[model samples]
Target chain A: MYRLSGGAILWQHHPGLPAATFLAMPAEPAPAARPVAAARRRRLRADRARQLADLLRHQILAGGVPGGVLPLEDVIAADYRASRNTVRQALDLLRGERIVERQPGVGTVVVCEKYPHGLDRLQGLAETLREHGRVTNEVRTVGPVSAPGPVAHRLGLPEHADVLCVERLRRLDGLPLSLDLSYLPMDIGGELLGCDLENTDVFRLLEQLTGGPLGHAEITLEAVNADAHSAAVLQAPRGAAVLMLERLTRLPDGRPVDLEFIRFRGDRITMSGVLHRSL
Target chain B: MYRLSGGAILWQHHPGLPAATFLAMPAEPAPAARPVAAARRRRLRADRARQLADLLRHQILAGGVPGGVLPLEDVIAADYRASRNTVRQALDLLRGERIVERQPGVGTVVVCEKYPHGLDRLQGLAETLREHGRVTNEVRTVGPVSAPGPVAHRLGLPEHADVLCVERLRRLDGLPLSLDLSYLPMDIGGELLGCDLENTDVFRLLEQLTGGPLGHAEITLEAVNADAHSAAVLQAPRGAAVLMLERLTRLPDGRPVDLEFIRFRGDRITMSGVLHRSL
Candidate 1:
């Protein structure tokens, strides 16, 4: 339990200590003890703010915050029985994490949103997020080009082989979601040039063209700073972090057909899955 | 083919164009065509730099760059038939991505590393990266605490129930790697108080204490900005993005045992997995 009164704090229980321990502090120090006392006060305020921030963060992540809008500073301070400065510091901390933003007239609002993406299923964005909204693709560019060394190697082609490069800007609910850059071997890609890429996903197109179900995919996921072009396309701030998914998909016959580099807005998507103990 | 000569460029092939379309340019325009021609020249240089950056990025990711050190600016310019200014711009782009950095005495060097973490296996840090380096844990805090609301719900306990909280700073090769905060039910955690937590993994200890093999875990992964405390503990730059992994582990009998929130330095870890096409 924590109690704050007259600008002084009493921490009854701390995680670092065992059960049943109390530490009491002086209520008000003398005025002559100014500099050292002020420093101690600042440190104590920081500690209290951190504790408040942790509790609020856990609540926000668990969707327990009512209405997704934080109460005013005075209300928070009164509820937590802390000073206004402490509440402000806690909000600042959450703001730095981008978990909350202070709107001009709307008070502090939760800005964190993470749509679930399953890692155990090799599904297209549209198929996986069917319940979310309509996923539309704006095919920015699509044509044949000479494959670079790494692309050719991944697709099991010789150096400088022709491959179709498809660049699309994907959106959900009219908001930018991902920028997908896909490379396909010319044999299958040549046929896709005439398909309706603006309406359908490449996974469905490949299956329709090959007349067989896609088998599996090998994927690597990481967070990388978005480059200028990707940032502009995804509507993210320059140098902001983006979730980069590099996937190589193979056909049922075990031929690698499509290699994709997808950059998703980090704040909008969360990848999830279940893992068993294999060992 | 892309050819540059006398400050004029000839782009014969482009990904957005058909198979073999030639784009020939006037080698040298008159001096009076200065303003418009200069703007076009700048745009052309920017395009060339982007193309070069893509090729170099692919090479670096594939580990095909000899010695992991880039060639000199002049050498790259000459080899690609691009101007020195274009090479410098491309290097600047790479530097912005943090893929390559310039040292005081050394030339540009690759700085990207993604240690593989398998999503298909339920393993500890030490078990996952046995070949990379020895993983050591600095047990910063370990004791009993009243469980927060969300944690109690996850563990099937009443709110504010007594639970064990363990905070650790993990390292790889003596470099700060991850900061993990774990919560366990008091039944199992009481025994952990007397164990050697600094030298062993909690997963191994739980199995030994329970006399049963662990079952599975549900995980959610996303990129989050590092808070002040996590940044200081993990030795990462303040507000830099880190990979936040929230995991809930269950016993073979379907009882949720441990819940953890692990923050891994985004640049130091990569999560990889193979997924089947499950409908």
Candidate 2:
């Protein structure tokens, strides 16, 4: 049987098995107790690593680490007053949860928790991202085009009906994230032709044009291979798997207002939320 | 300009452009109406394709097609009373929506929508799938083991505590869909040691064992690359992206009971639900 004693708790265990005895130690161990002391040191290191991981998780969730990049390992170790091995262990914990990824030469980077959109809320991407922090839009195209057959049907318009197409590359903290393509009926979208779309959200613009609150949306999420257009715009490799959100937003009275196709890089975004059972 | 005439409508427009004019026609035209007749036939074919697609979509959503595979194109054509080409077009529509994928030599298959679990419901996968139809479970393992450090912490048990580990491969319509690993405190899970797991849902068994309602769960969703163990069991390629749901379930009085890690094949499943904006 092996006996381990630190400052407070004394534990006795069979070698290579779990501890079966517990007792209190009154004083520090003698220097002859080298193996048990080493074990205690390892356990203390593990505790320290867990503590550091908890701190970093909170900081990351609170947006303290902007741009989703963590500091160098040595820097983190120095800051936490822990050994390099302890810091490595802590980062490994985050990596398992996908909260961070270690680049070969770039150090550990905090990569989890992309702007979360509540699947239950009828909100636009821009509005959702804005609530998190600063977001910018690069409007690629805004013009009238003949609606595609399927799009026309979804928008309750006749085949080949006029529609306004607005394509934007959305950026969060200056990092390219999602590509948003929205189609709007001509009668409602025509008014926004002269307006600056780069500074305005299409959902908000549609709300203003229709003079009513945008109601619920029928949203479908799918894993799709990025086509040429989406791959180039989202900067993902050709045919890479991406999360596609197809949304048809309607007015409060059930009049369809916009048909949007949004593509997000799967590696860079995670959509998550809590579900409460309704009584 | 090209002039096209159909029953009750006449239009003149560029041959390959959207129609610019529409007018009513009184009677059947002479042999000169052949071109317009062909165009009308094409339009009708397109309409028929869309209608077929809608019907198939509804049928698939209602779980009418078991094993997540659609019928052969000719079979679907015969069933819908549409031409083979029209049936192909309908399948193409489903492909664009990521609802079905065409296997190399196996024909088009309904690939997506594997028992959608609403983020709003506090339901287990087996429970949700059972509500729709039959579900079977293959219990891979059930035994007492030392809890891994992270799992022990998540379940609020001491490090190296004895816990019951259960691994199950869940099947829907006889096709393996998900691999689930659950760690439960021995004091709570010990009662289930002798129970038949294949025919019983774990959540239901837990409720019975604990004699209390399983309370809210802290759930997290992430896209993760499948590891070798998971890839082999789930029959997905190594490094294939999959949806991972990590849940820590609690009892009504806030006692953590189970820590679960569930992996779902991304292409075969989609988690989607409506969100309402709270005023």
Candidate 3:
């Protein structure tokens, strides 16, 4: 099974195998294949198409279909007990969402793909996705400045206390992924002024500077419209929604130290985690 | 501290106190308060304003300012050691993002508000947000039917196995919040047919019927443009982004049983959690 970072676990079809080899037998008893009256049938067909699209979406997300390739049209109609017209409409709806597309000879295929980002781990972007591709950081700004009110408070510093601010535009395989604004206490940040900010993860730098493993992070995730500056920096369309992640990382001794605001392109990243019930 | 579910912890100001009373003394040694020569100074001043805006944004998210109220313009200038003009420009930047607004006699106050939704719990909407307000489920569709491909796989059922599907439009207070689609294997969902789905959480019913607490859930979250159907049902703007949460829940014995696709009005809800690092 192939699990898309977006929480879709699609059935992965083996290369060289015909797509039809993986088709599952129809579960529901077949509905009458005959078409009904034109006017009423059109209305019912629209509704059925929607329902079929919804089902196909779940199937696609589940990875029940092979290797992102959808089964043949006749196969889907028979499996869902829907007429060919209804199946076509369903496929059309998926097309409108840009989730799937028709290829000249490849038939219907899933088009939307996202990289998985683990929320449960407190690793830097590069560390988490090291296997996927090379992650490069383009350092935009790095210098000492007084902590803003909120930044100071989270880092447990006095208001206006001097802190090191680092701004970076991170890319994955040459594609813009996120714009990260990070603040660190000057005392710790000062020692790393000469270190490689472009190639190394800050999490790794902090551990070396502090001489211990970081403890935990308090995270809040939300969707927000990208401002003009952020959109321009990330190359995302102006006003497009971006996933905003605000995190405060603390040392094992429980002192809050590093705070970061990372804005990720919503289309390219998916945050996934296994969460346990606390209460 | 007021923690916006989206992970902002703002300093709450007491009622009746003047906003300026909470201002902190300047942190940096006043950046040579003397204004520099024109052309260079104008460019410098613009940069300063952007910097100031960034700081204030952090402070607001961290809850440093009082009660979502900005300090008086002059007071802000004094605190950040900036000229009044730069402070005003910074405010204008925030206003552009619609995060804060000017109220004639009230000064600038935060305009964005979101309820907190915890990511580290296996509770229904009502259970998770019981303290905030009422959460009512508008049952849109419910019945037994053949499980879709993905639903069946997630539920450990055979292809097209009979299952129950429950669709609900959940609201907080009277505002539309989320549209939820839930799938359960027939044995468990069948028992919930006559239960009070509107007022009671499915988690509660599942616990009662299964005779145990749920184990955990695997969740994936991302932002997606709301389709026409979802946009209309949630009363959200057409094509506006929504937070999409997909979850697969299991029993204590690790049996996958319930699968859900929940789309939240991104503007109204925030998902927050504390994550531990586990390599």
Candidate 4:
């Protein structure tokens, strides 16, 4: 029995092939078939550079370059014994995929990747940071304020009720990257006011306060440009492109619990999204 | 009663409030929620560009750039009174969400986005081209032959079936940008040889010959460097990046139909994939 690649190709044997071969013994090479593993050893350096690129990409994704700093040219080319051009090509491939990006004057930066935002995930900002192998936070702004129209609309709050507006800047390896703004009802957040923002994440704080963890979440992806304020904090240029993610989380009983705004640098991210349908 | 953007925020309400206030309030003097749209000047500019960008993007997706050339920059910037930078930002936004690009030396080239090569939406190669805009095909080879493993699996034919393989180069506005190799069952496609490839899409021919049309398809996206032979035909450099799409098309009733191989210039085309809940 002939076997083919899963979900891609099928292989089936013909019972009448021998009989057919006897009748059609005189034919030229068939068209459109990929040549079976031919040998003509003029070139192809075993593609060691390509393999190294693969290794590096996997490492980056697996948090090998945990600090998000990657050497640009020297180490990779040296390790693979490939020309800088070849190494650069591999890096270019990654850059095209937005897996890594050059920071102009600085070295290449690894903008960590996250699971494609979805309802199935209700991870906290701290959990996402820890998953990427780095963590730091600075609460830029937090205060009790009268609910705004939109926020009040989402929270189903009386226009006069105060909501806690917590603006936290998240960092990786001491460098600020994302500006996360969260809104929590005063009822749920009243006890957490004295906590240090630089050292804590809201999700963990909420679980500690409520005695239960968060569950499903709904998130949306949008494209945005950084204004001067965001660019200065994120260390990117003003008007630098960004991917904006807005997420609202719910507990197991469908109670809305958290609302988060995640603004990711556009340069160094490669997010994977998958769709599987039920038959 | 209130409305939040269609995600998890719809249900949650601010405690102690029945409805949002200031729904009819005049624009506030200060920025409140969503810093991105906080400023009147910036928000107006951003919104105009976004709407215009969406308009142009639809045109591009509809294959309105048939000459494979258009003054994307001038038309956008002048018409919108947006700076070249702003217009470029809009283009880049579309570039990421859509598959189209501009090379330094080459004018803006329109690369028709290809359908996925997955098992669900196995569109015939020519039909995929037609969706891009007006197209013409020039057949290079058409005959029965052995099928590649990927093709074999997709067709669901016996591994040893004498597959009908058709190879053709396709063009838009006289510029050859893509080449295709399609495989079908030999008995089912003997009629394909009689049709004129230069004039019509092969799927239309298949519908006439086989009494049905393809329904759903699934596609996989990958990158491949064009070989010397492929580079010569596509007029692109060997080792230059090319977008490769491998697909399997199935009949409306779920029987396997056709498998396709498509190679496109990486710079000219971008790809769009969606991840959603399974139905």
TM, every model: 0.80, 0.63, 0.78, 0.41
Q: Write the per-residue lDDT of candidate 3 for residues B1-279, one digit (tens) a residue.
A: 332332222233233543243323221123564544565455445545655776786567555677889889998887776779889988887786566899999999987567789887777899888998999887755656665555677799986776666777799997899988787887788788768878888988999898878898999887766656667778987656678888888888889878888888877787888876655
lDDT of 1 by residue, B1-279 (tens): 222222223222345754334211112222353455566655545555655675576577766778889989998765544568778988888887677999878899998755777777898887788888888877755656656566778888876676776767788888888877787887887788767777688998899999988999999887766767667768877656678788899999889889888888877787888888864
Docking class of 4: incorrect
Which one wins on DockQ?
1
Q: How would you encode candidate 3's per-residue C-alpha lDDT over A1-279 as one tens digit per residue?
A: 332332222233233544233322211112453444465444435545656776786566555577999999998887775678778988987776566899989999998656778987888999888887998887755656666566777799987776676667899998899988788887787665667777889999898888888998998887766656677778877666678788889988888878888888877787988866554
Give the Cα error of residue A202 in candidate 3, in Å.
0.7
Q: Model 2: per-residue lDDT, tens digit, A1-279?
A: 122121322222223544222111111233355656576665445544544565576467557786788988888765544568778888876776567999888778877665665554777667767776666677654555555455677799986676666667777777777877677887787677656566677778887877767877777665545544456667766554566666788888887878776777765665656554233
Stretches > 4 Å off in candidate 1:
A1-62, A71-90, A103-106, B1-62, B71-90, B104-106
- Expressed as tens digits, the lDDT of each residue in B1-279 for candidate 4 is 222221111123334653233211112112344444335445334433443454455456446666766576876565433467667766765554434577788766665443322222234434545655656676654555554333455577664456665556777656666776666776666567656666677767767776765565555334444544555667765544455554455566766656666766544444432222222
TM-score of chain A of each: 0.76, 0.62, 0.72, 0.59
Question: Candidate 3 docking: what grade?
Answer: acceptable
Which candidate, 2 or 3, would have the higher lDDT against the true structure?
3
Interface DockQ of each model: 0.30, 0.13, 0.24, 0.05
Write down the TM-score for model 3: 0.78
Error of 4 at A120 (Å): 4.7
Interface RMSD of each: 8.5, 13.3, 10.9, 13.5
Off-target runs (Cα >4 Å) in candidate 3 are A1-98, A101-109, B1-98, B101-107
**Per-residue lDDT value at B197 in model 1:** 71
